[model samples]
Each structure stands twice: as structure tokens, then as C-alpha cells.
Target chain A: MKYGIVVFPSKTLQDLANSYRKRYDPHYALIPPHLTLQEAFETDIDADKLTNIISEIAKKYEPFQLEVHKVSSFQPINNTIYFKVKMNDVLQNLHEDFQQQLPCEESKHPFVPHVTIAQKLSNDEHSDVYGSLRMLGVEHSEVVDRFHLVYQLENGSWTVYETFRLGKD
Target chain B: MKYGIVVFPSKTLQDLANSYRKRYDPHYALIPPHLTLQEAFETDIDADKLTNIISEIAKKYEPFQLEVHKVSSFQPINNTIYFKVKMNDVLQNLHEDFQQQLPCEESKHPFVPHVTIAQKLSNDEHSDVYGSLRMLGVEHSEVVDRFHLVYQLENGSWTVYETFRLGKD
Candidate 1:
């Protein structure tokens, strides 16, 4: 199965991301707005064993605050625009933890925690959107208590396989 | 740290169990009523890695129906009185999955999924309580959507480290 792990932002954040996504993101229909923790990867491991491992990893961390402070873009790299989530020790550690623990290969791109609002744009369009969104900016914060282990469906949409809560008890 | 995996029944079931626990189980205050999936075991693995593994395992199974039909006792073996949970393929498979995947010794007893209501009774007390509870019987069913990975605190109470939802999406 093809699986990935992610943190879905709150409805308020989702509404904000969706506002931009509806106009700019091609993948707006494929997934809810989320912060990708692990890029999608194929794995042959049975689901039972896989979830057990994830449950163990989730037990270590407490709920942490997630903050999105501004609109940003991966301009020269790919023209992907996003809500740049502020990186803290908890988020950084979680990203690194998945990288080290999951069977998938290390991500080709460096971890930049973000909620992509627009992607696959031409340079001009990217510049137009990025400039306006950057000025309008964004400021949102919420506590993230859990993350989902999700799988792709035949229809090309993502669905949650399970949600693992964060923290020891 | 010492950790275990278990399913906490719904409030209805918990209250039922607690009523009996208050009088019969000596370890009642130590933990809530639960159906154990994995026994407590000590592990040196970091929390991140452990939760990841657990999360992966949880994603495999859909929520399954749990039914406790009668009160029973582990007679000649011991004085552990419990509500006998009917075993189905889903529960059996989950138990086997943990045994095969988790880093723990094989359980000394065979898997007979149950929610303990009493234990550590004397021969006479065992007979008295077992006779009364078994006659009272129990008939309850609930859909279990999640299971918890829990850790023992310094004071010895069990606390949830994380809760992993069952099923795809």
C-alpha cells in the first residue's frame, strides 16, 4: 500500500488553506489541508504491524502547538506556495523521528514544515499569487494532539488508516 | 520505560466493570478496567520510534465489535475472575499480530480475551464471588475504534501515551 503520515490542521486553518487552494492548488480535491510529516511511500508491510509501530512512536510526545505565521513560496525550487509553519523542537523532532524510523528512504527535499496552498504554477502566476498572499500574510496557532497514518485510494484521494494520539498517557 | 497496549471499553462497560472491581479486585485503584492486548514490558527504545511502530500497526484493522457475554473465573489456574469476551477473528488476529511484532516474551497463558473484574481472591472468596458474578452474567457489546499505548507512571498508575485509531481512513 502507499502510505504517508500527516497532521491535519484545524478547521479554521483548513478553511484558510482551502481559500487559497480553491483558486491555486491543482490537488485541492485530492486531500484535505495538511502538514506532511512523511512523504508518500510504498510499503509491503501488513497494516497491523505498521500501525503498532506508529502507536509506539506516538506515545512519546505530548500535544504541541502549531503556528503558521506567513505565506511563503518555494519560488525558485518549484513554485509551490504555502503557509510556512513555524518550526519548533517538537515539530523538528517528529519529522526527524519519522525519517529515522520508517522504512522509506530519506526525503529528497529538506523538511520544511508547511501546508501547501498552491503548487505546480508557472513563474508568472507564482509571482502574482505569492506577492499578494505574502502581503496579506497569515497568523494561526492551534494545539496538535494527534497525527494520521493515511493511505491512498484507487481514486487518488487520501484517507486516514488510523489516527495516533501524541503524548504519554 | 515500561509500557503496554490495551483497549479501554466504553463508559458503560467501564462502569459495569468498576462496580465489581470496587469490591473484588485488589488492584482496582492501580488501573482502569481494560482488555490487554500486550502485557507490560520494559523497553530501551526511544519514544518516537516506539510510537511510530504502534501507529503503523493500528492502521491495519478496522474497528471491531467486542462482546462480553458472561462472567467466568480462571479456576484451577488462578482466582482471576473476568467478563469473558467473545473471541472473533479480528480480536484473535490483533493479539497474534502483537505477539509476532512486539519485542516481548511470549505470554505465559493462552490468549483468552477478557476484562478482569476480580483477582487475588482466596479459595473461599474466589468461590463466593465467582459463584455470584457468574450467575449474574454480563451481556454487552461495543464497537472498539481505538486502542491505547500506555506507560506506567512513577506512582504506578497507567497512563495513555497515545491512542491509535483502527481501520483505513
Candidate 2:
């Protein structure tokens, strides 16, 4: 199964991100608002093994606050627009911890932890959306306590298969 | 008190890093063979508070292997030659986790996660050391099970103020 890991933002941030996604992202219906820790990877590793790994890692981290303030884009490379996450130590460590157990192929660029706002836009469409997006001036913050292990269904929508709480006794 | 956090490498790796340091680094006597997670910072936060925070974070992670290989330099910017520490999720997360609690202002760049082999060299000295050092090409790997929260003494050397074991129940 194809699996990914992510933590959701606060309700207000979720609403804000969802609005942008609904307007610009074609895959908005397939996934909800989240900061992805692990991108989708195909793995047949036993569920027990996955649980053991995540449980051990999650226990090491206390919940931390994650702030989202900047609207940015993967320009020239892709038409995708995203919110630049202000990575404090906790958020950065959590993502790194996940990568240790599941070593995905390293991409050309270092990982830019972000929440996608829009994607698959033409030049004109991107310009139009970006211009409108200027007034929003992204800003949202929330305490991150839990992350989910999710699997994609045949229809493309993702389902949360397991939820792990950070530093929960 | 001024404090720093670090993980010591295996004895073999320690010897290798020290050999390079003794030849090229001026601060070799002040510090020892270690991969710094956080540079020194002054904090009035109680020792108990510091210990509690670290203990909480340390419990969540299991020991993992760290590999230090590749001789590289932070040239033009810092003129420092170092061994690149290959950060898997464990090491990366550990560093990030520490940053959340003890944010240091002096680190102007994002953490590159390296162990300094040589520093504070004259232009001529750097060229000479860099040339001779090329043949020694670094390669060391070992399990990292514990880390220390240490403090500097009046004479400039660091002493272990506290030790936190990884994955301790």
C-alpha cells in the first residue's frame, strides 16, 4: 500500500488552507489540510513493524508548536504554491525522526517542509491566483500533538490507518 | 551557565577527528572529539528544568547508528574543514529537538550537522592542511546511544554536567 504521514493544523488554519486548496488545487478533494512528514511510499513492511518503529520514535518527542506565516511557491520548477512552515526545532526533529525509519529516496533538493496551497496551474492561472492570494498574507499557528499513518485507496482519497500521539504516556 | 549539547563518536572515530584537529585546529585543547548538537549558550533556566526537558525528549528515541564520512570545507564563509556527519532521522531529530528548548543566537546558518576537523588556519596554513588532509579521507561509523549536556569551565575545557541515555525506560 502507498502510505504517508502527516499532522493537521488548527481548525482556523485548516479552514484557511482548505479555501486555497479548493480554489487552486486539483487534488483538494483527495486529501485534507496537513503538514506532511513522509511523502507517499510503497511498502509491504508488516503493520507491526511500522507500528513498532513509529511508536518508538513518537515517544521521544513532546508536542511542539508549528507556525505557518509565509506564502511561497515552487516557481520555475513547478507551478505549485505552498505555505512556508516556520520550522522550530520540534517540527524539524519530528520530520527527521520519521525519515530515519523510512528512508525515502533523496530528492534533488533538501526537503522544504510545507503545506501545498495550489498546484497544476498554467502561467496565467498561477499569476491570477497569486495576485489574489497576496491579500491573504498567510498566518496561523497551532500545537502539534499527533500524526497519522495514512494509506491511499484505489479512488485516490487517503484514509488515516493509524494515529500516533507525540510523547503520550 | 554556558552549556552545550553533543554526542561523542566511537573511540576509533574520536581518534581520527582528534588527529586532524591536533594538526590544524587551534581550539583542539578546548574541546574534544564530538558532534555538536547545540553550541554553547548561557541560560538561567534551572538545572532541574534543563534535566527534566532533556529527559523527556531522550526517552522517545532508540539508539541509532551515525556515519561520519567525506572531508569537506565551509570555505569563503567559515574557512573550516570538517567531516560531514551523515544524519539519519535519529541524529537530525535529536539536534532539532534540542533547538526548540535552547535556541542559540550565534548560529547564523541552518545546522549542517558536521564534526570540525580543522579550523582557524591562515590562508597558507589552510592550503597546506587541506592538501595533506585529502589523503586521510574520513570514514567512521558507530551506534549513538547517549548524549551529554555539558558546561564550560573557567579554563575553557568542557565537562559533562549531565548525561542523558537514549531510549531509557
Candidate 3:
């Protein structure tokens, strides 16, 4: 359990989470899409523990672009559709803000932003998501200047933990 | 559909969409989050139609804060999230742009500007999403400039369609 901004968009991400809720837990409400200013740490980690981490990371960053996306699935096999932001330097640096606050030696994969489309699904559901996506192919790209903090509950759905926008991307 | 522009900070949105591809639909991915000049029409559409609608709406806007949130969701229902530009004169004007474009016979809904996060969730799958949301609770807000245009495909994901940034907001 680490602390960082989990970027998701407005109603779209919430709706995706809702899809999971409708299917599985029945309690998976979502926050908003955003980036983090903290780094990876364990669960329930307090913000007090992160002050130093955030400062250290911020000290190094001047605000860079947090790439907007990377299409992926909740699970490869079950493959529910989902799109998320790229964890570029700006995003990583923003996460570093929280990561630096954590105590030394935390074991966790680094954070990358993502908008979950559904809970884990098997073959048939996977193809349905893919089918929908196949039609919406990429036409262009844009910029993101904000970061958000999010948390995952036992149900495995993510909620808005926090959000911070940079002065510049 | 009524149209409006949801402005993202910068490249952060672009990267998010890029990352979304890694796990979701790798083929045609989402374009970056941006200001949209058109709405989700009630019927087929194109840029000419959108521009005509937007040009008029643009005049009504006096410029205001389009607070960028982390993400908003559409799912189990839509399985998606997006950044909501805090409703303002700008958003209203954008929406007004499209409203004017609609044929007198067309029905319209309130227009809003925000980015998409996820989509395509069947009902039975996301029943629990309600309670799942409180977890995300917002943490940050950002001020942004510019409106981006993006479109979602039959697949139900979005890509940057175009961008129109206006005076400070």
C-alpha cells in the first residue's frame, strides 16, 4: 500500500468503477481522476509521514508533463477494458512527493496512473470490452498538468485519495 | 448530446490515455483529455457541425475557472472517470454553443465539460459501485486554460478530437 495520486477522469472513471461495483462488491464508488504528489508507501500511511518525502520530490521537480494514457486491462486473462495515464517524470516526481514522506525501505511496485474500466472478467467479457475499444481507435494525444492521490479498498476498487495540479506541465 | 469543453492541465491527460492502452485496448488508444467544442449529438456528427455550434457559444463565455478534478466515473454503468471543469460561465457558454446548434425538434440535456475516464460496463457487473466511491474523496484541484476536443468510438473510449483554449480561467 503506497501513497500517490491515482489519475482517473470525471464520470467516465466512476462509471467504470461502477461497472465493477454492479458486478462484484456493490460498494465500489469512485472519486475523480487526478495525479499524486506523494510516492509509494504502505497502507494507511499518514500524510505527516509524507511531508519530507513530498518536499524532497518537489525540490527536484519543476513540474513536467504527466503523460495521459496507456490502454490496458484490469487483468490480462479476464481482460476488462481500462485506460490510464502514462507515469512520466511529472507523474513520477509527483508520486515521489508522497514516496519521500514514507519511512525508508518500502517494498512495492512504483505507481502508474490508470482508469479502471471493470472488475476482472473472463474470456467473453474480455472480448466485449475489446470489441468496444477496437472501434474507438486513437486519433491524437493531449497534455495533463495535474496529479491525484487515490486509495484502494478491500473490494479492490480505487477511490480518489487526493489531487494536486502543477503550475506547469 | 449537448457539447462543452473540459480543459485538462496539459500533457498529463495525453499520457494518461497513452498508458491506458498498455492494459486495455492496445490497438487504437485514447487521445489526450481536452476541451470539447461539441456535445454527444443526438445523431451523427462532424467538425463542421461542431464548429458552427461552438463559435456561437464561445461568445457567451466571459472566462472563468474550470477547476480540474482528478477523475469522474461513468461506469458498471460506463466504467469510466473524467476531470470535471467546475461548472462555470465558460462551461455554460460551451454547452450553449451546442444547444444552439441542435435542430428546434431535438431534445437537449444540461451540457457539461469534463474528460472521460472509462466506459462500457454492463449492469449486472457493477452493482456494488455505490459505496465503493467514498474512498476516492478529492484531494486537489487545479486551474486550467484551453478546451480540448475528443471523441469516443463505438468501442466507447475517447481520443483527442481537437482543442480550443480561450482566455485565462
Candidate 4:
């Protein structure tokens, strides 16, 4: 889409994912360690469009901070996955922002933000993947300063398209 | 060349040199707000050769934990620019682990690792480049994990050749 927000990891995230993978990717077939803020879609986009959107959204949002919690996973519904992110008010607010502005209204499942490490496979892939992630071990909560705009390409791979400062109007 | 890590956020790194062009294309830039561990290399690579190296290397590494810290930058020399990673003991250990087996040697730049956000412009592009980055307001000091083996393609783009687990070994 022309514009949207994405939540993935910083390069340092690879470190956290690797630690988690050492333990999880081997034993658990965790979805690769990435949590998307929302699915990408084609839309009319650009800085002017973004600036207008941000200004419109900010009018109602004063600004707030949230804490990213410890590692957790999704159950048998999909593949097991591990993620690190702010799960409280900050996340809820961002979600609320999307629902008001985007198509998140169509998601079949509730959004649970995560940064992916391993992905798509049977139980067989876990032993190696999880073991690798485990070696990386657990990481502490990190701060989130901005919201990202990412695009999922034709090949089913996701790439960040752009970013926006959340509290700044 | 056969075995190398290109670092994460390489997706839009092409934007580094094209800094003066336009902000519309984050495609040439690394994913916004990510940290890199090392200045990854583009080595002699082919899928078969790279995969073989990975399959062999994967078996050797075991996962480990690291303490990630604040944002820093590096100017090895006046003209050279880099995002600097803090040196923690655990990180040092991981560096040694990687150095022993990988085809490329660890950077002599004291491993002040970082997933780069932008390229330091040549003296020629300096003024215009900094002006652009200031408007972008990129953030740094990211946590790291899962070292990826990426392929820098002929079209001046990067594709993840393979991602390797470090601690799971």
C-alpha cells in the first residue's frame, strides 16, 4: 500500500532472535521472529499524504509510552512463535490508531505484536531452529521511539516501506 | 566471499549512496530503526557454495546472551562514518566465536558493530546528505541476534541468502 505502519526489530533484534532461536527454532517451530503492526496494502502514498495523515491522527492523540513485555508465544492455532514488544497501553493505542485509519478491521485474529525469528515448517525444523535461538537466550524489553511503515512484496516477503514518529505531530 | 554476513537492514542500504536523491525510496535504505552487529561483507557467493558453508558452520555455533546498550557512532578517521556498537564481555565472546569459523575475518574496526542506517557520504555528497538524514531522524542502539548470510545482487540489491543461528550450536 502507499503507506502503513510496521513493527519489526532493529538490527540488534537479530541478536535477540538468534538467542531465542538457539532455544526455540530447534525445539519449537516458531514463526520467524517478526511481529507485524498490520498487513501491507496498496494505497496512495507520499510525504505530503503521510504528513496530512499524521497531523489528522495526532489531533486526538496527546501521546503516551508503553512497556514491552517478556517473551511469549502463540499456540497450536498457527505455528508457535516468540516475540518482544510493548504489550500494554502503547500497543493498544497504536492498534486503536490503525483501526481508525486502516483495514485492520478485517484481520481474522487479534493482533499480537512480535518480531519473528523462524518460520513455516513442520515439527521437524524445531530442534535445530529452537536450539539456535536458545543459544541467543532471552532479551530485556527495549524502548520503541517510532512507528514503521512496511510493505509485503509480491514474493510474500515483507519489507519496511517507511516510518513515522508516533508522539510527534 | 563464499561465506559472509551482510548484516540486517541491508534492504534499503542502496539508499546510502543515493542519499541526495529523494526520501521517497526507503527501498535503498536499511529497514528503518534497526541495529547491525558488524559491517557485513559481500563475498564470493553462489547458493550451493553458501549453503554448504552454512550447513557446516551451523553445526559449530552454540547460542549465547548479550547485554545491549546505548546508541553510538564511529568516525574511524575524519572522513569515515559508522554506527558504533558497545563492547560488552558477552558480545566479545560471540565475536570470537564468529571469527574462528567464518570465511571473512572480523572487522579490524574494534568490532564497534552496528547495522548501518545510512552510508557516510563521500566528501562530495556531505552537505546534502546530512540535511536529508536530519529530516529522517533515524534512531540507533538496537539489540542483535541471528546473523544472516545475505547475497548482494547485481542489481545493487540484497537478498537474504540464508540466515544462520549462532547460539543453538
Better of 2 and 3 by DockQ: 3
Residue-wise C-alpha lDDT for candidate 1, range A1-169, written one tens digit per residue? 7889888766567767878887899877566778998899888886557788877888878899999889989878899999999988777888788888887888899899999999998999999999999999999999988887766654355545566778954
Q: How far is candidate 4 from the true structure (C-alpha RMSD, Å)?
A: 18.0
Candidate topping lDDT:
1
What are the models' TM-scores?
0.53, 0.49, 0.37, 0.42
lDDT of 2 at A72: 83
Q: Which segments of candidate 3 are over 4 A away from where they belong?
A: A1-4, A8-28, A33-45, A63-70, A74-80, A95-113, A138-142, A150-163, A167-169, B1-169
Question: What digit string (tens of lDDT, one per residue) describes model 4 on residues A98-131?
Answer: 6666633455777776665554545666545555
| Pairwise lDDT winner, candidates 2 and 4 | 2
lDDT of 4 by residue, B60-104 (tens): 555433222332333335232233444565456545655664555
Candidate 1 ranges with C-alpha deviation above 4 Å: B1-169
Q: What is the DockQ score, from 0 to 1, of model 2?
A: 0.01
- Per-prediction TM-score, chain B alone: 0.96, 0.92, 0.55, 0.53
In candidate 2, which residue ranges exceed 4 Å CA deviation? B1-169
Worst 10 residues of 3 chain B by lDDT: B21-30
Model 2 CAPRI rating? incorrect
Which parts of model 4 have CA positions greater than 4 angstroms off?
A: A2-4, A8-10, A18-34, A44-51, A58-69, A84-86, A103-105, A124-137, A156-159, B1-169
What is the C-alpha lDDT profile of model 2 across B1-169, one tens digit per residue?
Answer: 6788887665456667777777787766555567888888888775557878888888989998787778888877877988888878877777778888664555667778788889988888887787777667877778777777766554455544455668986
State model 1's lDDT.
0.81
